[model samples]
Target: MEVMDLGILSLVPAVIAIVLSFVTRNTVVSLALACLTGTLIAGQGLLGFPTLLKTSLGSTSFAWVMLLNTFIGIIVAFFQKTGAIQGFSQYIQDKKLSRKAVQLVAWFLGMFVYFSDSFSPLFVGTTMRSISDKAKVSREKLSYIADSGAAPVSVLVPITGWAAYLSSLAIGVGVIATQEDAMNLFIKAIPFNFYAVFTIIFVGLIAGGVIKDFGPMKKAEERAIKEGKVLRDGAEPLIGKELTEMEPYPGIKPRVFLNFLLPVMMIVVIAMGTYLTIKSAKTMEAFLFVLIFMGISMFVQGIPFKVIMNTLTDGVKGAVPAIIILALAYSINSLSKTMGTANYIISVSEGLLTPQLLPAIIFIISAIMAFSTGSSWGTFAICMPIALPLAFNLTGGDVTTLVVASFAAVAGGGVFGDHCSPLSDTTILASTGAAADHIDHVKTQIPYALICGGVALVGYLVLGFMSI
Candidate 1:
């Protein structure tokens, strides 16, 4: 079969898998099926199945992707197992920190972890939930903070894994002179990232009590307090039980404040040191540096080697779904590129849409695709080829604005859909981290995402017209 033919047919299974996931509320099964279907379509025959799997696993890019996620998972798991996160939580609770202070602390903590977007939400949510609960803050609000901090901070930080990946894409398309140039452009574009900015502002407002609470979230907060429900789901009910069983590191004199303060300060110092030293290094080098820092930090925390191994293993297991989703998303994107589906989209749309409206169109299309597919990186991979070319064509080949606009579309639309889509890994993980109902997290975040998305749309339109 022709590549294009296979590409067209591949959409069927992907779409079906997405629909089934929504209906069944099972992300793992849905993503696996979608991946299997895409691989089959790419191969065009049952006999090619083994080769397809081998290709995906053997792909150097995919390996790096998985390694990055695995490392993040291991670090987070070590933090949790060593009582570091719980100690931090206890310190915050003991201080009787104001809700606003707690939220700001959480935000910065997430920002520090911006090197890995996949792990930011998990780290922030798990580390901060206890403090927020004690302070009577809503878990929905906590999700908002985590979601806002994850991708937005990663995109803005020039030394992050996200920046490297995005810069590589820009360089691949000749949109920038070098990876460093691309990173610089991305940094400059941060001020214009209205979704991220406004989302952070909104979180501050909610935390400060200026916004109070409204909508479904307001009701959830009221009920939680009234019913004495500290956690959201309250079905599995891990928070109280975990709290009761939690103890300081065995045989180590527990200075509650130091236990928390030491780990946090260490994380910040190591992260900054790693960033400065590895910013200019190759992807593998940067990743290795981060891995080493995480390992040493775990050892310094006095977490036993066997326990650290167990935690790391569990962390890797936790990332299994994310890894699968990313690989499949990459496969879908690869198949699309190989089959010229992206080029076809660009060619067909070029004459029909005005140059000034291309960014907006790309934003809308990306939003829809991400909402349906529930993977931001996948959406980015699939859209960048076509969108970047369109931006170049639209701007008469001025690469700077075109590159920024294309990235804006990817970042804005990717977050918009992922924030609201129940099937998104971040969405699920946010709920898991907060112990909130998954659907509730999705429902509460929709209005915030839409509001920011609306601002972004207007900003893109203004920029597009001015550039034209």
Candidate 2:
């Protein structure tokens, strides 16, 4: 069914949803309500919400997300069950690294496993958690490192899933004439991806102890350094207790080099190899390949098949909340598209924004929208169609720096929410991977994210006027 033209009121659903997300601090509920509101508005009555949701769930993209994230959960569980995480940490510990060195290593490992953002937190967080704890590092800090390592690192690198998908969005906006043009623009936008680049630098500063902790993070850091507590007292970790508490099978020694290194190498190699050759990285396929390889390796090591199956089930169980969140995220994005949220926002701002302020305005709007929705990809889906065209027109068709700045704004702004929002996939995974309390992870991470956002905000404002 076609949507009713609500004119300016098309903004109401998203506004309410964004308000609810802040007031309730419940991501799934906020997004669902938002989707329902938009769907109802689109239908001009109460009956259409269900149909909109049903369609969203049945969509191919939603199914792909479910499978992709489900596989990631299974990978996390399999590694934990097979004791690959523990073995990797043990290997690190045996080197007798200091706390600083351990954090630096974790920071680097996050970037090292940069093939898939979906896989990075589980791989880096699970593997590094033990080592970070041993080094007296706070779980909150570890979660930050893992998230920063995954999304920000992946965003800047063209070979990863983030770049490939976003490059397509650039093409969809009709600014770039072809996929090749979009890819070239993506390359040019890299340095202007200020938030992502600054975020990576901030993580290094934290890991290297150049940036002192403040906010909730400082308290968490103090507890870790002064009291030797990795997680705060009575905090509930997002990852299942089963996975975190699981042990290696009896009398089967885990090998860091064989089990950990080999499987990780396979995931990276296949992800990059396929992307370079085929243009699509196919992250889920890479994960499945490593998962099967992990299973065979475990079987060779004498792990019981039943135990492995159970471990995989536990992995899926752990990811259920995240999966629900992802579904709701897609639903809202689709509904908002139907409701004309992006067009309304653009229409309202059309006369008010000057080209001198376009980049800054786009950056802030994209960041806020992404943060409220808890999906950077969805934010890109919404904002790119409007923002890209605006920048293209404002600068007389991509001839100047404004076009690149706009692309960077959308990309960086999208990642800004991924870093700050509790509902973001990377943020959630970072908490899960580090075994940190979900809310605690968000509270501790947001301050640092704000720091990066602030810097990027200023940079965009400068770039905006420079375009004039």
* lDDT on C-alpha atoms for all candidate structures: 0.63, 0.79
Once fitted onto the true fold, the runs of candidate 2 whose alpha carbons sit more than 4 angstroms away are 1-53, 172-175
| Cα-based TM-score, every candidate | 0.76, 0.89
For model 2 the TM-score comes to 0.89
Runs of candidate 1 exceeding 4 Å displacement:
1-3, 6-10, 32-82, 99-101, 172-175, 179-184, 212-216, 230-251, 255-275, 278-352, 372-375, 378-382, 397-407, 421-432, 435-440
> How far is 352's C-alpha from truth in model 2 (Å)?
3.6
**Could you tell me how far off, in angstroms, the CA of residue 227 lies in candidate 2 after the best superposition?**
3.6
Across residues 83-107, which tens digit of lDDT does each residue of candidate 2 receive? 7778777778889998878888988
> Can you give the lDDT of residue 191 in candidate 2?
98
Provide the lDDT at 87 for model 1.
66
TM-score, cand. 1 vs. native? 0.76
Worst 10 residues of 1 by lDDT: 235-244
